[model samples]
Target: MRMRLLVVGLLVAFMALTGCAKNQMSTEPGTQAGENAAVATDSQNSNGLSEQDLADQQRQAMAAAEQEITQNRIYFGFDKFDLDAEAKDVLKTKAEALKAHSEWKMLIEGHCDNRGTEEYNLALGERRARAAYEFLVMLGVPSSNLKIVSFGEERPAVDADNEAAWAKNRRDEFKLFK
Candidate 1:
C-alpha cells in the first residue's frame, strides 16, 4: 500500500509539472498556440470549408434531423416500460438530434391502453416516460431539456379494444420544442 501511494504521488507531481510546463509554453512569446487559435477563428476552417459552407451544412443537418424526429415514437410491450432494440435505435437518433440543436427541448409522452384502472395506468405511464427519459439522459441528452407527461388511457392511438390497438397504445411519443 505504501508503494502504491508513492507511485500515485509521483504521478500527481508529474502531472502538475506537465500542466505548468504547458501553461508556460502557452504564455511564451511567439507561441504557435496563439497563431493556431487565430487561424481557427478565421472564416476558413482546417477542413477547407468557409464559414458560409459550415453554416449551410449545419442547416442541412438540422433539416434532416427535423424529418427524422418524426420516427421518434418508442413502442413497448404490454405492461412493460423496458425499451426494445428498435426503440433504442430510435432514441439514439433522437439523442443526436437533441445534441445537434442545443436550444431544442423534447417532451416524452407516455400512454397506455384502456385496460388498467385510471390511477394504475397513470403510474405505469409515468414509469414508461421515466424509462425513456432516463435512456435519453444516458444517451447524453440534457435532462433540463426534457419534460415527461403521462396521458394514461386518456389518449389512445387507436380506439379499438383489440391487442393490436393496445400494442400501438403502449408507447412513448416524442415532441420537439424550440
Candidate 2:
C-alpha cells in the first residue's frame, strides 16, 4: 500500500512539472500557439504588478516619450510664486533644454499639497504653473509651445498625513505632447 501511494504521488508531481515547462516554452516568440497561450494565462492572472516590473514599465514609457514635446511644472513654497535660487537654477536648465529642441511642445501642470481649502489651493496651483510658464517665456521658450493647468490640492503625490508627504505632494509636473 505504501509503495502504491508513493508511486501515485510521484506521477502527480511529474505531471504538474510537465505542465509548467510547457507553459514556459509557450511564451517564446516564433510559436503562435505558445504566444496565444501565454496571453491567455496573463489575462487570467490579475495579480498586482511587482516593483521591478513597475520600474521597467516606467522606463519603457519614458523611452517612448523621447521624441515627443515635454513640459515641466515648477514647484513652490506655500503661498508664493516667486522662484527661489534653486528653483531659478532648475528653470534655467529646463529653458536651455527646451530651446535646444524647438519642435517640442509642453504643458505645465501645477499641483499643491493638501493643506488648504479647495478653492484656495486651486488658485495657488494656478499661480505656481503660471510662474513657471512666465519664466520659460523669459528664457526664450515660445508661448505657442506651452500650456498650463492647475490641479490644486485634489491630487496629492503622497496621501499620508505627514509633513514629508506634503512637501512631496506640492510639486509641478511636466507632461509631454506628441
Candidate 3:
C-alpha cells in the first residue's frame, strides 16, 4: 500500500511537470502538434534529442559517412583489379561506415585508363568495382546496400595523357544514393 501510494504520487508529479511544459510549448503563435510532441519528448528522452534534433543528427552522420566513402578513391595498378594495402584500408573504413548505417545505399562506379580497348576497359572496370564490392561484403556490409556500375574509361578524374593522369583514372569511385 505504501509503495502504491508512492508510485501514484510520482505519477502525479510527472503529469504536473509535463502539463506545465506542454502548455508553455503551445503558447507560441503557430505551435503544431508535432512540435509539442517533440518538446514533450525532449523532457523525457535520455538522448535529449527532439524530433528535429534526431533528424539533424542523422543527416550529419550520413554526410560524414558519405565523405569517408567518396573522398578516398581506390586506385588500381595498370591493367590490374586487385586491391592494394591502401585500398583495403579504405574499404575497411567504408565497411565500418556502411555497417553503422544500414539505411545507406551506395553505388560503386568502376573506371579505367584509356589504354585498353573499349570492351577490355569496360570489363576491367567492372572487375575493379566487383573487387571493391566483394571486399566490402567480406568485411560485413550487406550486399543489398551496394550496387556496381562500370563507366570504363569514359569518366576520367584527370583528363590528360600522362602516367599521373592514367594512374588517377585507373580507379574505383563511390556514389551514395540520395
Which candidate should be chosen as best, given TM-score against the real structure? 3
lDDT at position 23, candidate 3: 59
The prediction achieving the highest lDDT against the true structure is 3
TM-score of each: 0.67, 0.58, 0.70
Q: Which model is ahead, 2 or 3, in terms of TM-score?
A: 3
Which tens-of-lDDT digit does each residue in 68-120 have in candidate 1? 76555889898899998999999998888889887988888999999989999
Per model, state how many residue pairs clash.
0, 1, 0
Estimate, for each residue in 52-171, the C-alpha lDDT of model 3 and write its tens digit.
888899999888988998887899999999999999999999999989988888799999999989999999999999999999999999999999999999999999999999999999
Off by over 4 Å in 2: 1-73
At residue 44, candidate 3 shows an lDDT of 89
Better of 1 and 3 by TM-score: 3
The list of candidate 1 runs beyond 4 A from truth reads 1-58
Off by over 4 Å in 3: 1-55
Number of the candidate with higher lDDT, 1 or 2: 1
The whole-model lDDT of each prediction reads 0.88, 0.75, 0.91
lDDT of 2 by residue, 36-99 (tens): 8867766664665665677888777555454332433345776676788777777776666677
By TM-score, highest first, what's the ranking? 3, 1, 2
Error of 2 at 13 (Å): 92
